[model samples]
Structure formats: structure tokens, C-alpha cells
Target: MNVPKASEKECIILTISGRVQGIGYRRSAQQKAESLGLTGWVANLENGDVRMVAEGTPDQVDALELWCRNSGPRMARIDRVEVVRQQASGVFVGFVIR
Candidate 1:
């Protein structure tokens, strides 16, 4: 029950699975994060998973996570989404595919 304040900046690291690679996932996620006014990066993992790190307000982060769990990249099948809340690193400029 640790709800963050509306304007409190936060960060989250998400690991998404299931057909996440080669489906424009990284690009799509990058776009999504940017559209939500977030700063972060998305990349493909070696174990066939997608990793995303987003920094923004709590609501914004939650929104992005919801999208990732439900309807990810257009042609992607998301089976699971692992989320980790972490300290915001005030370093990201924009979302990138890395």
C-alpha cells in the first residue's frame, strides 16, 4: 500500500515475454513510452524476452506497464510481464531501442 504521489517521479524495469522479439516490440515500446511523455529504453534480451526501463510519474509508468501486459507490439504475443519498481535514475533523455 505504498502509493506514490501524483507528481512523484519514478522508474520501473519490465521484462516481457512471449514472441517479443522481431515484432517491432522495441520500436513500438519506444513509441509508446514517448507518447506517454516518459524517458526510457527498450531492448531485446538474449533469452527471447523484452526489457523496458521507463522513468516518469507513477501514473505514466503504470499506464505503460498495463499496455505491455495486455496489448504489446502489434504482432506480438505477450504471455507474461515482470515488473520491478526502482529508484529513478535521472539520466534518460528519451526512449530508445537498445
Candidate 2:
């Protein structure tokens, strides 16, 4: 994917479903986000979904999405990914597994 020259940070909320729980999805997501210089947190939902809130440049966000789709984890089987863009808020310091 082509990296976009982003001037401002972007916020995105990603909802991942399908065999997300009990896998290393959250850890992998946190590592991926941190490597891309993103700030966010990842958590497992009660309904067997994984939720992530991330903030970074468009390119970084796109990379994270691509990684999630391609290789979430060994035990994860991603069926769907829902992403929503929102106004950026520079509140988080680093990516974390929650």
C-alpha cells in the first residue's frame, strides 16, 4: 500500500470478529500499532469480539488494518473488520493491550 503524507493524526475504531478471543489478537494488535507509531488500546469484548481504538497517520492506520486482515494471530480467524474514522485526540501515549 502507498503511504499517504498525512499532516494530522486520525482516530479509528476497529471491531474485529470471528474467533478473536483466547488468541493473541490483542497482543499482536498492540505490537503492530506501536510499531506503526500509533496510540491506542485493544480489548476483548464480551461477545467474542476484539475492539481497538487507534490514533495515527492515515498510512499507519492503513497498515494496521492490513496486518489485522492478513495475520491477526495463530488462533484467530477474522471474519469481519469494521473500521470507523473519527476526530483525532492526542490523549494516548502508546499502544496497549487492555
For every model shown, the clashing-pair count is 0, 0
Q: Score residue 37 of candidate 1 by CA lDDT.
A: 87
Full-model lDDT for every candidate: 0.88, 0.86
Candidate 1: count of backbone clashes, pairs at least 3 residues apart or interchain? 0
TM-score of each: 0.89, 0.89
Candidate 2 residues lying further than 4 Å off, grouped into runs, are: 1-7
Candidate 1: 10-residue stretch with minimal lDDT:
1-10
Error of 1 at 3 (Å): 20
Candidate 1: segments with Cα more than 4 A from true spot: 1-7
What is the Cα-based lDDT of residue 44 in candidate 1?
A: 87
The RMSD of every model to the true structure, in order and in angstroms, is 4.5, 3.8
TM-score of candidate 1 relative to the true fold = 0.89
Query: What's the true lDDT of residue 65 in model 1?
Result: 95
